[model samples]
Target: MKRVPLYAAALGFIVFAGFPFYWMFITAFKQNRDLYVGAFDTRHVPWIFNDPPTLEHVRLLFGQTDFLRWVANTLLVIVAVVIITVALAVPAGYSLARLVGRWGGRLGMGIFFTYLIPPTLLFIPFSRVIALLGLQNSLGALILVYPTITVPFCTWLVMGFVRSVPWDIEEQAMIDGYSRLAVIIRIAPRLILPGILTVVVFTFTLVMQEFVYALTFISSVDRMTVSLGVPIALVRGDVYHWGSLMAAALFTSIPLAILYNLFIDRFIQGFTMGAVKG
Candidate 1:
């Protein structure tokens, strides 16, 4: 009897969480008229079945707008940020976890705290830097700025995962004539694979969702990232292209959803490792 309410609660939560995505999917396939009429109207709810679903919005998004270009630009920036973050964070995390030095741990914590500084506070200063470097409206600017937040948090996350790993194994490798760096390359990578995957996914997702920085830094139509492109291309002044907007949103979300599912096991393990002390 108790299980009945638990199941009911679980089902309710799932519906609450999943309804937005479902709506987006539905709206993506919906005719503009259907969306403008509003799905909440009971009168129009049945019209969803009567009206044949169309791929017109998806077709229009790709054909009319530089959506593919925007996607490519966003992907390029995300890939670069992920590479930079992983390369820098992994070593920084390991050093913070394994090395004993004055203020090592405190320094790691301090560096991570820098990420908590809101982008809103930094945008004006960043704009001045961008203008000076001539990176205004360039994808390179986004790539450079993105790592400011991704690296710090990712480094902190990886630090915890690295700390949870046993150093005795690395010490044994060192005693067998392997250098510390060699031991890390040969042994630590295997143990921390899950953490690395976690960082990759987290960094990718964060970069993909970021809007403010992309909006502020980019103005060229072709140079705009996905987050910026969608709103600019789909929404006119005081007018929203609901169908195309939904299609673009759905398209953007699909890749991330697949990535999450693919690495979900390792992602969960990474968090678990970070949370529990060995």
Candidate 2:
């Protein structure tokens, strides 16, 4: 009897969460005629599965767009951000948690607060910086700027995670003559594995979705990230390419979803631990 309610709740949650993605997936396969007919006709009974599916959209998208380049650029930016974030955040977080006595918690919060400053306000100054460095429209410019937003928040997250680790482990390792660098390479990785994975997944998704800075900074078709690239490149001005747009969105999201699902338990552990301990 108790399990009945639980099952019902789970079913409801699944429907709520999965509906938009299901809609997007089906919409991508929909013929343009069906899509526009529904859009234009008020009385056209909305039936997603009822319409005949087509691969024309997928073919048109891949054939006509610089989608692969966008995907490649997005991956490049994400990999660079992950490297910079992990390298900077892990060590900085460990130091903040262990070295600072009473101020570590407060400092962590302050660093997180910096991430809240809207990117809208930063883009103008960032654009100037990008131009001055002569990296305008280059992936390197995004690689440079994205870290400013990603690092502070990731550092704060790592600080909370590192704080949760039992100090006795490090202390014993130290007495056994393990250096700080050795602890970081050997012991810390095992201890903070969940936290590290959380940072990877979090930052990867962020770079894929973040747009304001990308839009303002990158105007060249070859240089745009997936978020900007798909919409800008696939559609002519004022004429939306719904099929290709949805197709791009579907393909881009699937990999992340699969990866997240693979490590969901660890991801949840990272969040709960960070929240409760911090």
Candidate 3:
């Protein structure tokens, strides 16, 4: 009986958090009439389907746009960025935690501060760099720039995560004649797996959702990522393709949502522990 309020609260929270996805799901399939009805029209229920659902929006999104190409571009960028962030952040973090001695914490904080600088502010400078490299209108631009955003914070996260790991195990390995590089390569990684995963997931999400750099650097339709592509494709002048917009959002977001759910435990641990420990 005492648990009833807790269950109700949990249910309420779920519904509240999930309402937008619910709206997107229905709006994606809803008929034009069902969707455009005035809010004052109480005769039609807004929450439930007012008419039979259709796949027209889905077809429009898949058939009429470069959505698949955007997906591929987004995935490629994600893969490259994740690899770069991990390769850079993990080592950088471990170095700060173990190698930098007493100043590591201060250095890690300074690095994390760089991550806090808004992407909006950095995109202008990045645009110049991309132009210099001749990567304008290219996926390569995104692959290059995203690491700048991801690496700093992820480094701090990994540094904190590494700090939380017990030093004794790593010390024992070193005492057994394993070199520092060998300890990092062989043993430290296993203990810091959660932090690395956190960096991977964070980098993936950042690359997927980012728009400023993608839009600034990529002008060609085929080169745009989903975040930049969808609105440009769907919104023509003042007319909004709400159904297709919703469909595109629903499609792109579900996989990310699923990924987060799958790793929610580790994600929370990595984020919170990293912040607190640091």
Evaluate residue 62 in candidate 2 and report its C-alpha lDDT on the 0 to 100 scale: 85
Question: Cα lDDT of all candidates, in order?
Answer: 0.83, 0.83, 0.87
Give all TM-scores, in the order shown: 0.87, 0.86, 0.88
Which 10-residue window in model 3 sums to the lowest lDDT? 269-278
lDDT of 3 by residue, 32-146 (tens): 9889999999988989987999999899888987888889889998999999899999999999999989999899888878877988998888888889999989999888888
RMSD of each: 2.9, 3.0, 2.6
In candidate 2, list every pair of residues with a backbone clash.
none
**TM-score of model 3 relative to the true fold?**
0.88
Cα lDDT of candidate 1 equals 0.83
1-278: candidate 1 lDDT, tens digit per residue: 69999999999999998887887888889776666775577766733444778899889888987889998998899899999999999888888888756566788778878987988999999999998999998998998899998888888878877777777888888999999879888988988887888889989988998988898899888898898999875676788777788889888888988987886665554445445543
RMSD from true fold, candidate 1: 2.9
Error of 2 at 246 (Å): 0.9
Candidate No. with top TM-score: 3
Check candidate 1 and list the clashing pairs. Answer: none
Error of 3 at 196 (Å): 1.4
The best-first sequence of candidates by lDDT reads: 3, 1, 2
